[model samples]
Target: FTPLLLENTQAYEAGKTGTEIPNVVHGVGVFSVIGGSGSTLGLIIAVLIFGKVQAERTVIGISIAPGLFEINEPVIFGIPIVMNPVYMLPFIAGPTILAAVSYILMDTGIIERVCLSAPWVTPPILYQFLATGGGIKAAVFTAIEIVGLTILWLPFVMISNKQNVSEE
Candidate 1:
């Protein structure tokens, strides 16, 4: 993920502008599997903090630790976001919106391009800082992404909780 985007940005930034690739790569990391591919960390937080469903809360509780390490398999499969239609919209939309926003910020020079390479499991805020070579702006942008994702996921979580309650 980082390599392709990083290479494109580096090439474009190095005065080799032939293709239409923009000098924006770090944004990929901003939205990548942080808290899981769909930004499930936000979803997890939503469940734990505001979700009324006991089962959902338990799933989130069990998944939170792995989520912190950027592992979302449990939440993804456990919360069943993988095929559940209820969570489909926010699951896709959250990361897409965050990526678009992050890209715009980076393109406009609000945040720096990611020049450093870090492992995918580096965690969220810390990953941004290390990937951008200690740029605080990257970390801040990551924080914004997290907040944005949280907001995006909140509605779906509430809806799911409501459905669960009515069914019970």
Candidate 2:
């Protein structure tokens, strides 16, 4: 994704001096898949910290380990985020916003372009640094994205918890 998106940008800047090298696409992987699509690490944390329903908490507890490794089958199938309308908005919006922010940061040279691909399961902050060739800015940016997405997930998780309580 990064290579492809940057092709034109890279070409345009090839042999050019004083032109901003377009590296926005490298950010897509870092931002979108930092903790898996939708930044499920944030979702998992939101669930564990605020989840009131025993069932949901149990599912999230089981999911956290895998979520850290960038595998979210447990939460997706267990919490069944798939086909669930309630989580639809956050699921879509969180990654989109994070990716957009990441692109802006990389495009503006606030953070370095991701020059290497880490293993998919490398984990968040560590993965960010590794992917960006050891840039502390990448790790910091990742932390910000994680926290922002977690805040985005917070209210939704709380509302779901309240609904579960009411249903019981």
Enumerate clash totals for all models, in the order shown: 0, 0
Q: For each candidate, give its TM-score against the true structure.
A: 0.84, 0.86
Pairs clashing in candidate 1? none
> Would you list the clashing residue pairs of candidate 2?
none
- Candidate 2 segments exceeding 4 Å error: 2-22
Q: Please write out the lDDT profile of model 1 over residues 1-168, one tens digit for every residue.
A: 657667755765565432234547545655555687888989988888799988788888899888987899998898789889999998888778777777777677677666557777878899878766576887887888777778888999989988897765
Candidate 2's residue-wise lDDT over 54-162, tens digit each? 8888899888888988888888778878897777789888888888887877777787666565788888888878766677887898888778878898988987887
Residue 90's lDDT within candidate 1 is 84
Which consecutive 10 residues in model 1 have the weakest lDDT in total?
A: 14-23
